[model samples]
Target: MTLALSVDGLSVWYGEERAVHSVALEVPVGKVLALIGETGSGKSSVALAAARLLPPRARMEGRVLVAGEEMSALSGAQLRRLRGEKVGFVTQDALAGLNPVMRVGRQIAEVFQFHRNLNRRESAARAVESIEQVRIPEPAAVARLYPHQLSGGMRQRIMIAIALALRPPVVIADEPTTALDVSTQADILRLVRELCAELGTGILWITHDMGVVAEVADLVAVMYAGRIVEHGHAASVFDRQQHPYTRALLRTLHDMRAGQPGDPLFQIEGQPPSLNTVITGCPFHPRCPMATSLCATEEPVSQRFGGLEGTESGLVACHHLGDQAGAMT
Candidate 1:
């Protein structure tokens, strides 16, 4: 079967300011691939590209395939169908995603009406069912309320309800649980996991939280300076990360110390270069402690270490993966 989502040699730019640099990834059916990066790392840019959701001024290169259809090459009408029925997208800010003037129910009902060509009455019933599926109480009443009338978590559930209602083959969830409380966040995460396990929907999960990634991701990709620096199985990347950027990120994960209270967090030196900044050699060399003279002037190609069924190696773009591997053993 064709992959649910395939992004190859994809580059994105906003008026010559690069947002994504030749990033490539795939999310197969029933799997979750999480993109982890700090702010402005271009994780969201890649996610949006999966549905051809980039801003009007943003020029995109390469091709995006959604369940075997080339998204970038599609006509406007075709793109709309792909976005509406083939891939469901959930944004981080539910309030922003929802129109304040539109009642939540009518908004979700639009999916059934537009995609499935259901009549108003039928669509309305399905809309309520969608709400109930996400475990929102008082579905009918909740649907009648405007987006602002609902709590943050409730609004997010509505977003998920809308996305899952159509049973899209691929789901791009861009930090869907970032704004919710811990308990509510866990509920949403569990819902997404269950969807993947039971429904066979491939998911591209974009978030900055490693905890969230650990909870939901089967595969993990680390992005830095608009490019994927490393990608591999979650277990492999977490237990034995290869890229210096990946290692630095893992080292900074908060831990429960045996006796020490409030350990000072490890911080990576320097900040990520701006999108317009001219980066020579490795973009990460400026802040990476393991950088050498060679790293300062040469870009490293991705090298594989290990993958699923042992066919794909954990891929890393770093000058010292070999030395890092030796040191680990």
Candidate 2:
């Protein structure tokens, strides 16, 4: 089966600073791939690069194929057409994603106008349909209201509705349900999963929430310092994480799950290295507990794990996995 989205050796740089380095993954149609990492781990950068939405100052390299088309090769007009028509995006900040001055209905209908040859009435009808599909109550009234009138959850739902209006084959959602109550977050994620399954849309879900990943992800890619450190079937990655960073994240989640009470939450120590600094070895070495002297001098190439049957493309970038086999366990 052809992948809905395939990224190979993708890298992005902001002038002299590299934000992401050689990240790659594939999202098959009807599958949900979660890109999980803490803030500033280049999760959002990866999402933007996939959609060809990176800033003017940023330079990108490598292949980003969406629906068999090379996103990086598309021209201005072609890329514009592909953005909303072939690939949709729901940004992390719904308030910023939506136009404050425009009516929510018109904002959504604009997608139809841009991607489809629908008149005002037809576009309005379709926009209302999209809104209802995302489970927004009183779709008509919600359509008539401005972005300011809606609650945070409602705004997020509207963002999703707008994104799905054109039925794009790939959806890149950057923390689409953040800042909502637990109940609302569940509802939003369920709606996204259901809609993607029904439409066979590939979803690249960028988030830091492991709970959400456990609920919706078919595959999981753990990113750090702008590169994918570990990727595999979501179940396997959760059950048997390999990379030290991935293990730390899982331990943090376990701490949260146990309802550990304290203002001082557990976190990986040390800050991420500056993008301008040339990282000779693993970018995660400074904070990695299992890092060896070799890890500080040589970069570890991603390698497929052994002892796993029916697994493909599962990779971990680490030098100590051989010696620290029992660390994650």
Best-fitting candidate, scored by lDDT = 2
RMSD of 1: 3.2
Which window of 10 residues has the lowest lDDT sum in candidate 2?
A: 257-266
lDDT of 1 by residue, 238-300 (tens): 888889899888766664112133333235667899988998989999998898999989999
Scanning candidate 1 in windows of ten residues, the lowest lDDT window is: 256-265
Summed backbone clashes in each candidate are 4, 0
Residue 100's C-alpha lDDT in candidate 2?
A: 96
lDDT of 2 by residue, 162-201 (tens): 8888888899998753366656776777789999999999
Give the clashing pairs for model 2: none
Q: Cα lDDT of all candidates, in order?
A: 0.82, 0.84
